[model samples]
Target: MVPQPFPRHIVDVAPSVGSTIWRYSDSFGLADPEAAEARLGLGEGGTPLMPGMGDLLLKVEFVNPTLSFKDRGAAVVVAHAIEQGAERLVCDSSGNAGTAVAAYSARAGVPCTVYVPAATSNAKTLQAEAHGAYVVRVDGDRAAAADAAEEAVGRGEGFYASHVWESSFLAGTKTFAFEVWEQLGRRAPERLVLPVGNGTLVLGAWLGFEELRLAGLVDEVPPITAVQAVGCAPIVAHATGRHFDPAPTIADGIAIAAPPRVAEIADAVADSAGEFMTVDDVEIADARRRLAEVGWYVEPTGAVAVAAAGQLGDRGGTTVVPLCGAGLKWPGP
Candidate 1:
């Protein structure tokens, strides 16, 4: 008998209401996030791993529920909390993650309060407000916002839906790897290229592939290649033998001066046989422009992967990249 096709994990879920997938191990009360997503027409993980520059398979995650890849995590995390009888949700997000949490929380009839830094772009802050999030314009920088949120969470003001530290979100995000493996006909990818702000995607994909391997689904975890903007690349510096300097960068989405999950990010990088690289702000801008020409409107940070993928020298065939966020999330043109 021939081997069954991969991605068949949901073959019987019908993807509609009253549908159920196999034992996909719903984490964070999102046991059915994928199913609920398919029915709601949120356009979840079914993103095209389409061909792109250098014939790479690019997963357009920007096409998610809130126009950024964070929807995967937000959807699962928020919905799970709703299922758990949670009332209010609090989060600290610069742009993408905040917007995602707001939208998903609204879907679940939960009040979402987001704390964004003073430097957060008007576009993102407005989007958060548009999604009915209690957008609190905090003072200081992104790191400061996290601290403020932490303090508030510690005070039991609300349930802190930390995008970085949420294990449920990490599990939901990892589905990207399973989808990628299936899209490639169950063949392991040559590489997984992406951008690292909070290192959410990298960690998710790594965990997902590990689960798949344990389930006898895949043979190995694909190599991860995460790229960061030179302006703020603490993880890259930590991984590439460079000095750690938490400077600001134009890629505000990935301008994580200090990520709460630093050690996990570093370990995930090494375990996946991955290497983190940094690119200049100018190069990021150029990728954004070029992607726009392809009708790929992504934020500067989202394009960092394209910049890094191009530099990888084409040895790894069938590269998988994700456009982590949409351009509309950026400030005014």
Candidate 2:
């Protein structure tokens, strides 16, 4: 079956009176009656947008039910799978996305299988296992796990709920932009700093804000800074015409050496008058520690945007950063 198209029009419907992303269901372009009935949310989205270090504002995405922002997309993906009469769900991740798909699949009463890189964090793997998902540890990088999951789908093991390839996932993540706009008094922020691995959030934000702009809710899409790990920064390298050899880093979440949507990711950033930046493992650790001291304990990957924030030249605008995952996801220093 063909993938659902990304939503464009924002209907003039009243927001639902809750914190769940289903509150914006009408905007996601799901069918009217089914939109109300097919809401499978565990209170994802509606995270706090609070002031952070200096002039930065932190969007605390780790407050999600799964302790990461992946909940937002996973919830919708599972619902779509159920709508398609899927008997089982399959996905691949380094950690957070698999855990999210597992949790949401559990909620939808669907069996799930998650494939993860062998080096995935124990905390994340345990979470998926606790959700009763059969976990397979692939012996290569993130892409190998993805290949395993796709092979499972090809063998009819389950529907592919890929966070990287699924358009429905982007539809769900667009709620991040919606919430950000609402939190800032129905206006887009001057800029958005986000961690990029597969560019799910970056593309989602682009789609969301563009819809808002088309609906006349905002003047234009905000500039986006896509942050990546210095050790594995294909997007940055692509943008700057630099060659980078893949290496291991503490920021495993953004350690994708070859993201499937690399070109689209670069276009989104450039379209928004934005740029790419990379931070090393040392910088990530320092940023994580600083966030901990400020009572926002985010994982090293989650701290990537924060680390890049300091390197940004004084653009003199309201900059927002997203802390994408919880510190507990990776307890090691």
Candidate 3:
């Protein structure tokens, strides 16, 4: 019973957009056809292997359907949209998520509207547009665009496909941890490092392992090591006894100044042996370059885990890191 789980079906779309295209039908394809696809590698699971990043294994979840782990959740989101008989869908993504939702909506023959910050990366915005989604470029910051999208949806515009507060997306996203288990031969890691934004990767993976444990498929989830950009770490501020701080980091992906799921994110870290850390733009850039040199192209946000790894103490066991997004999604500086 994780908090606020989106219906298994609406994992991808935010409720602010339109009718959901997903359903709460089954577990990570435990005995279902879609689950089989998850195994058989039809661009489903099995992201990529970046061996020996540390004692922790690196699962390149960024390689999913839309070139990011977001695709997994987006699949659930769009599927539910169909079930709800939505005529169109709406979403506000800083980058990857909008592209993911738009692409999946196209696959399902559903129209999608994406609201993006005017400063959104060109590559990501282009990707969403290429997917046949109507791109709404709002003036002001990312949150402003999100607010506008919500308002539009509230006015009977379309499904919101809001990712921040949606719980189902986490359920869909949890599948990544299960894939990590299968990739690691069914053994849970001692620690999992993830780059946090709205708590998607952290929360999603947390729930996935819990579900597996409930089904007796695994024993326990490892303590998670969640990292964020120094400029935009709201939870880190909270963790360090700060009531609130204004974050403004260039690791734009995880530079979330305010997360609606703050309480939940903090609870997950505290409950597990997890700790949250932050890295600077220089560190984020360095990590990005290093990962790319290894042929693992990751965005600045995706590389925060790698940057944090440098500061982490010995946990004395395996740790798993989610290499979240593709570098290509970011346009040239």
Candidate 4:
């Protein structure tokens, strides 16, 4: 069967809002009558939009059910899997995505297996295992884990629930923009600063705002600043035509040396009149600590956007940054 195109139009339904993405299920176009009958969720989305350093607002995504924004996408992906009668799910991640998918898969009563780089933090791996997912540690980097997971799918082990490649995941993530628009009084922010690895959230936010724009809700999409670790900033390197050698960093979540959607990510940034920036481990550590002092305990990767916001200073209007993951996912010394 040919895959249905991702739904875009808002369906005619009662306009009642709730705290979860399902509140706007009609707007997201994922809650068809049949899918809604067997929908799966863990109360993802509708996270707080609170104050941050200087004039920046923090979209507290770490408060998500899996303690990361990945829950938004994972919830939708798993629901799609179930809707398609998938018996098992397979995916790969450095940390947060694996844990999210595992948790959601468990919630859906489907077996799951996650592949991760051997160097992934124990806390993240343990989280996935705690959800009863079979965890496989690949010996090399993030890409190696992805390759192994793909091979498993190739061998008919399970449906590939790739957070990186799944459009349904983006459908769920688009709620970030919707929630932000609602929280900001149905208006779009002047700018969005987000950490990028596989560009899931960045692209999702763009897609959401574009939908709003097309629906005559927002004036225009906000400019997006995509942040990356200096150790593994392929996107920034691509933009600047500079050579980079991938290295380990405290912000492991954004340490993607070769994101499959690198070109799409670049185009999203450029189309929004945005720029890319890199922060080293030292800066990430500092930002994480600073946020902790203010009661936001996020992982180093989560602090990446905050770190870039500090470096960028006050440009103008409202700038929102996302604290993407819980610090406990990788408690550093």
Error of 2 at 125 (Å): 0.4
| RMSD for each of the candidates | 7.5, 9.6, 11.1, 9.8
Instruction: Order the candidate numbers by TM-score, best to worst.
Output: 2, 4, 1, 3
Give stretches of model 1 more than 4 Å off: 1-43, 244-246
**Cα lDDT of model 4 by residue, 1-333, tens digit:** 999999899689865346888876666445462354245577788899998577999999998999999998888888777777799999999999999999988887889999999999999999999999999999999999999999999999999999999988898899999999999999999999999999999999999998999999998889999999988999999887877677788889988888999999999888888899989999999998999998988889999999999998767899999999998998566
After best superposition, candidate 3 residue 299: deviation in angstroms? 1.0
Write down the lDDT of every candidate, Cα atoms only: 0.78, 0.89, 0.75, 0.89
Taking the tens digit of each residue's C-alpha lDDT, what string does model 3 give over 274-298?
8888788899888888778877888
TM-scores for candidates 1 onward, in order: 0.88, 0.92, 0.86, 0.92
Which regions of candidate 4 are displaced past 4 Å?
1-17, 27-39
Q: lDDT of candidate 2 vs native?
A: 0.89
Say what the RMSD of model 1 is: 7.5
For candidate 1, write residues 1-333 as lDDT tens digits: 998786635345444432111124354345565555543224456667777555677788887778888877777777666656678898998888998889877766678899999879888888888879998878998888888888888887788888977787886688787778777898778788888889789889888888878888877787888788887888877777687556667788888888878778888878888888888877888888988888788888788899888788858577888888888877745
